[model samples]
Target: MEKTFKFTPEEFRTSVKIIQYLRTAIGSSLENHDEQKVRKYIHQAIVAGHVHRDVFGLNPILTSLQTAQIAVDEIGLHRDGVIATLLYGSVANDDDHEEIDQLFGENVARIVMGLAKIQKLYEKNPVIESENFRNLLLSFAEDMRVILIMIADRVNIMRQIRDVEQEEARHEVSEEASYLYAPLAHKLGLYGLKSELEDLSLKYLEHDAYYMIKEDLNATKKSRDAYIQQFIAPIQEKLTEAGLKFHMKGRTKSIHSIWQKMKKQKCGFKGIYDLFAIRIIIDSPYNLEKQLCWQAYSIVTDMYQPNPKRLRDWLSVPKSNGYESLHITVLGPESKWVEVQIRTERMDDIAEHGLAAHWRYKGIKSGGQMDEWLANIRAALEAGDNMEVMDNFKMTLAPEEMFVFTPKGDLFKFPAGATVLDFAYRIHSKIGNTCVGGRVNGKVVPMRQELHSGDSVEILTQSNQTPKHAWLSIVTTAKARAKIRLALKETQVKDGLYAKELLERRFKNKKIEIEESIMGHLVKKMGFKEVSDFYKQVSDGKLDPNDIIDKYVEIRNYQENHAKEHEARSAEEFEYEGPVEDLSSQSDDVLTIDQNLKGIDYHLASCCHPIYGDKIFGFVTAGGGIKIHRTDCPNAPEMRRRFGYRIVRARWSGKGTSQYSTTLKVIGNDDIGIISNITSIISKEEKILMRSINIDSHDGLFSGNLVVQLEDTTRLQALIKKLKMVKGVKQVQRI
Candidate 1:
């Protein structure tokens, strides 16, 4: 007999009570059908007791329900977010994405999937400090609500894990809460949750310090209350006499913050002053909130002299994370300075709930600052360096914006320390490409000069200026760096092409045919990674063509001698003369084109000479047989446009079965021994055979057509690249 665990009658009742609570809480927010669906899932999760139990043996269903409640009441999420939180465990454990989408909608499915991915990420127990690890974590969270729900869920878990026996796991969770999630919450403007997370983490990780502070706060509770009441009595009377409707409270700083202050100031908890701040929340209409806040600021400053340096006026300009308030430090009744924060009801809500309240007040679907931040995330991911993405993400999380202006006085906001080049790219990529420098406040400055707040900037552009690889190091913004990298890559490709053409022209002039294998060995021995990199160096005039040719010849001779020695040994070991079958042309399988149709009568098109592994498509010829042409064939666009109905999608089914015939046109200076040099290279190549050569010589120029046979495009491209490296070859092209 096997033992089993089932929910007790009391546990089942507890779950039902939670469900009723959720029903009342979510009553008007969700449609009747949606509410029923959510309850149905909750009921199922409760009955499936095993699904709720973790290694700690806690009540799983209750945990999820409590998490959902936090998401609703604390995080201000509505139906879809609530539903995803309720079903996260079930969806993560089961592979029923279609069922989730069909029942709830695609949004719910996506959020659940993101949650599942993050759960998997946590299960790996990755090193928390790794940047790539953090990047992957953010990338997995495709939707912002996923992050919010996870934060809420983490808070619920933190609340419940205080008594768990697994001390090590508890400590790890607490450390993670401090390291990743708390900062995330703070970045999102959820100061309340941020403080809660930090306090709980400290309680678990620094038990002695946490309790010490807690006991001290408890001991000082009576005096603190008296002091707060005495301090606010006069201010409340003044505001009331001024005909303002408002409420005031003394907000204590978190235990973690107090501990931090003690460590920084090298003092005891009692020695730290300003442990609590008086927050005055005003009940004012939207238009008058700022005015009333200023009035309150003036009244308080008049009543008690305020420290001008300690005044913070965020009401004039809200933070990038949507935090707005007015803070002042004033001399109080006992000559002790106290911090006071004043804000309207709306501002207070945003300050308390972070982006959730901001989203609600602004209409959830509207494109606001948060949406722009999301777009920046997408762009950073596209830049393709995971570490860079993580850096940009961390910067954006708690971004401090500094305002700058264009020559025309158009205002722009950039992260602190942003450069003039960053501004140029933000204006337009074309401007960035041509930016020579900038004029900051009527003074010409280098492009890398950091812009100060309120500095007027005018970009200087020159047509001949282009993006250099060095620009990558100069720009601070991710957008500028990504665009500069793209421009440099494009320029490198064009330069490589030009160098290859010049090398081939030189090879044709020398009349030396090159061997790709020998040249590849030579390039590697010279410390190059790829042949194109070698070409780039050649375009930069870093290597002479004559020296490269000499090296190629030396390597070729050495390889030939090594091969002869092996052949001689093999011939002496086993001497059996027999006719060998030529199986090279044997076909492996017919091409499996698109549309699942096979065995079609088709041949490789001569116009493009497409080989195995080439991107291809089928064209019905006038003879009714299909012709396979490379997608990049010069004639493809014209054919597709002229005979749209005759074109069909196609691709190579497998590796090439046999060799292909191709033609190369060579042009060079009419120089002595050039033809011999070219013919010598072709005859020495083991895999390539020259079928024919037709030459025409005119004044100062030699042009020739050479036909060769090789297995596939890979070999054909190698052959062309080799021919391009000859000393006098000016041009090489496949015909």
Candidate 2:
């Protein structure tokens, strides 16, 4: 029996301040049916030591709880989310789903379960592809609150990473956070989280560089702060005089971002100026938000000499991630560069919290732009196989974006370096599959032509045109690659089916029955893993049907002659003493040598040499007593159709001791000593006895036929391998 501890009503009432703060932070949409119970859960979590002690030696439960609170609270999620955040780690560890369900309800339990699955996924496959990561996230798309929780958890981990002891673990965690989690945050419109994650990752990954930037910023903080105050003073006075309600604040650049600028500009810390940005948050009416942002932008530029080329008018057209801010870099006091941002309070919140803030402040439905973006991501993931999905994921995660247009004025966004084929596939898979080439801005361009922003693309398609293998290398988008591979595979399957039909017709004409065993041998002889591959080659005209038929005929003749000679010699020593057993029944059962027919010798036919494992039938020839032929022999159909009365059932009694003769064709470059090399290899194999060799040379290529004797198909295959390794040899195949 386990003791269950619970929080009392008095204990919950004492935490009213915390609950009220959460309620206000989360907005009016939040609801708590029993605030007492929610508070009690938090209290229990703290008492269980889940809040105070560090979970992963980086962040304590309290820190994660706060981060989760900020995440849900900013998004205006319901009260269950708040309770789950506090007890997520505790419930996860104790497997206390029943308690959570009974107290906080099933929704809270489900969210915690999703979080546990996410943690497990990350732990088991740390190096998972972006597509797989997206797929995992989308699995919980029905309840997107889980993803929000994960993002919050990641943010808290990065914030408290400094407390982590092992340098190696910190480096790994930071790299994953930077490369994987940061891009995800950015994609989700969590710009603040993205920037923070990037900065924290850079802090540990590039410690020396981080500290240098930090030390430089601190050393110049006094002068920087004074300069910012001087620059904002006039703008602040004018905005107030204009009756606009606003608050101006100075923000220093994050160390991670500062380092990025230094690297991108190829300069030292002193050479890099504008280490801070001044943000003006205006409190405007709902309808006047955009107008107030522009007004502030004008007031700020009027106070300083603004750089026209450095201005970003994102307020006019919000970024894809819903970021709305007007940025301008100006020459400030002391001739130093300074960046200023102008946005309304709503815009400011959206900028800080990204998608969550966008939804909460804008009052947009869940199925709007955010859903559309997620659908696109899901489409990309579903479009390709695992490897291709990963490639697409990386492409999607790329920060640099370009906007291209179709002939109909439809706008499309793609990563940098995406080509015309990628554009076609992005439009539709069918369009990409049939695309021959395209015109870019009224000029004919190859499908591989890299598109630029604002270019009008017109895809030129043909009905007969299908995706080519080379198109895979040309297209950069995951969707294009996946569609191309699928089309190619379909084509291969179609060709294989046609080849199979063609082979069947050829065998029928040659009076032979096609069998799986016969096709297996042919596939092995042609160096194919499966019969379908051989069929594809045949359908593509790479192999000759006549050559295959002739080889089968040759094998049948050899077996027939050998069987005739044995039957004649055995007849001299033995005489039948009883009625003959039913050959059909004897063939179906385990075959054994008949003592009564000891004198009447019979052997495997030369024409269709029946191996120990082969399905066979015996034919009594005019001179030979009986000849064994494989059921799928080239002559079996003719024998069965015409001389049906003469055919007798046959089966192999035991393994033969004698070697079997097989013919091999070797093709190679007509190099000097190439024939000698082939002969040398065959001679080296002690078990392989060479019967004859014939070589034909034409132009720069040579083809040779070598007849060799081996004990079994295994030895023959081994000999073929040895022959294939000879210098200048292109192919070695049993005919």
Segments of candidate 1 deviating more than 4 angstroms: 1-5, 29-52, 92-94, 130-136, 360-735
lDDT string for model 2 (1-735, tens) is: 113334447544534455566667654444455557766766676566554344344323455456656666544445555566766766536377778778766667766776665564454333432443454354433345666666677777776668767778778778878876777788777777888889888888888888888888889999887888888888889999989999999988788888888899999998777778899999987788888888777777778889999999986666766677899998877887888898888888878877656534433223445545544434432332133432333223324566666776555667779999999998998898899889987899989999865466899999998777888899887777898899899988898889878878999987887645445655686688877677777887989999877766665566445544443232112221322332221222233333224334465667655544556777888886777777888899999999998887665544544455667888877643566656667778875667666767676677777767655566777777777766457899865
Per-residue lDDT of candidate 1, residues 304-326 (tens digit):
99999999988877776778899
Cα-based lDDT for every prediction = 0.77, 0.68
By summed lDDT, which 10 consecutive residues of candidate 2 come out lowest?
570-579
Please report the candidate that would top TM-score against the real structure. 1
Off by over 4 Å in 2: 1-64, 72-76, 92-103, 128-135, 138-141, 333-335, 359-368, 371-735
CA RMSD of all predictions: 28.8, 26.4
